[model samples]
Target: MELTDLATIRAVLKRHGFRFSKSLGQNFLTDPSVCPRMALACGADESKGVLEIGPGFGVLTKELSERAGRVVAVELDESLLPVLGETLDSCRNVEVVPGDVLKLDLAGLLKEKFGGMETAVCANLPYYITSPVLMRFLEERLPVASLTLMVQKEAARRLCAPPGSRDCGAVSVAVSYYARPKILFEVPRTSFYPQPNVDSAVIRLDVLPEPSVRVKNEKAFFALVRAAFGKRRKTVLNSISSGLGLEKSEILTALERAAVAPSARAEQLSIGQFAELSNRLEELKNEQ
Candidate 1:
């Protein structure tokens, strides 16, 4: 159906009486080449199952269905259901699920839709909900093998950024801990039907079998990471002490024991360093 064709898209929307929802970040991809490239980047093959979020107009869904054994697309906007039905009519392997991915039972959905298959996520994510969606993807620890997502260029940078880089944030740390993120390519704003203000990038995150760093407590590890990045300008020791309600002296002692400099900023510490610091602090707390 050539879903990425602007004229075809316009005609379908007009026929379905579908109006874009600004609040929902409804920028549909109109560039024909982008979707195929994104699908290729996902490494989807006849053996793999794919879960797509926000399949606006089903352009990416169509591309994915061509390569993957099964494609389950979850769309939040019900108005697009008819449009997707029309666009994806010939794609027998595609399933259009209507629901908020954030609220859905992802584990159950994966088990039901993609059982006994190597699964992956490929989506042109809504920019506003990118962080939370990525967090949910990682935190839920879904059985998906990888995620190749279209996100804001800046966000892609942050997600794939190294721990000691300026672009690194709490999310960056979390992403690094859980997956190996890399920016595949950038998409110009003109790539969309209604051009967005900022450019987008395709990022591929290969989920690790286990986290990159080992710590005694995952909750405590994440809590320490959040506190480290809570106040960017503050020293890691001060930030952890204040954010975690630990004594500054105790934090300093833990830092020393972990071989981390007290003056080091969160941005300057590696994931291993954070794990070390977190473990030392946990030990000190247990001792007291």
Candidate 2:
């Protein structure tokens, strides 16, 4: 079956009496060129196991199966299981695991399905759950080596944005701390069955062995990052003080100790600087 063919996809969905759910952000990939590149970007190979999220019609799943030793896809929509089963029947290496990727115990799942094989993740992620999904994978420190995801173009810039750049946000800092991110390529709105309003881009994040920066407390570090970027318009001193509920004097002291200027914006600080400030602030809080 030509899964990327518009007519073929329509016929197949009709045969199964399937309907696209807007709430689920069901836009199946119609561009034949996309899946191959995404699969390659993640370095999917015979020695690797690839975990896929939202395998609409098994288009990318098939591509991964061809390269990886095994492909396990987590599909949240139960209705698509049958559709995937029919489409992916020929691909003996592919397994359609029906569940929410966000809720699943990924470490357990990877251990069970892939055994000791090197693992990677490839997905055309829904825009609505992009940040949460990516964060879950990163925060949990999953065993995956890399993640190749298709996300909104604007989000791609932010996710791959340098920590101290103007495009940087709390998520950008978190992503930077966890992995080395790069934008691989772009996918236009015309590539999907039900076209979206905006264009998309494919990005690859190579998971780091250790965090980009070390902090005394991961909880306090993230809290400070969120607080810093919480009000981008404000100076880092003002924002961190307001967001962390610390006195201006305390925040100023911490910033000075960290060698960060009080007038700097959140976007002006690197991950290391953020970690340094977070550690200093934690020290002061403990002293108090």
lDDT of 2: 0.93
Tell me each candidate's RMSD, in Å, in order.
Answer: 0.8, 1.0
Q: Cα deviation in Å at residue 48, candidate 1?
A: 0.9
Q: What is the C-alpha lDDT of each candidate?
A: 0.94, 0.93
**What is the per-residue lDDT of model 2 for residues 1-288, given as tens digits with 9 covering 90 to 100?**
989999999988998999999999989999999999998899998999999999988999999999999999999999899899899989999999989988898889999999999999999999998999999989999899999999999999999999667789999999999999999999999999899989999999999999999999999999999999999999999998899888999999999899999999999899999999999988998998
Residue 2 of model 2, lDDT score: 88
Candidate 1 is scored at a TM of 0.98
Worst 10 residues of 2 by lDDT: 162-171
C-alpha-based local distance difference test score of model 1: 0.94
Question: Candidate 1: misplaced stretches above 4 Å?
Answer: none
Residue by residue across 11-79, what tens digits does model 1's lDDT show?
999999999899999998888999999999999999999999999989899999999999999999999
The Cα RMSD of model 1 versus the native structure comes to 0.8
Please give each candidate's TM-score.
Answer: 0.98, 0.98
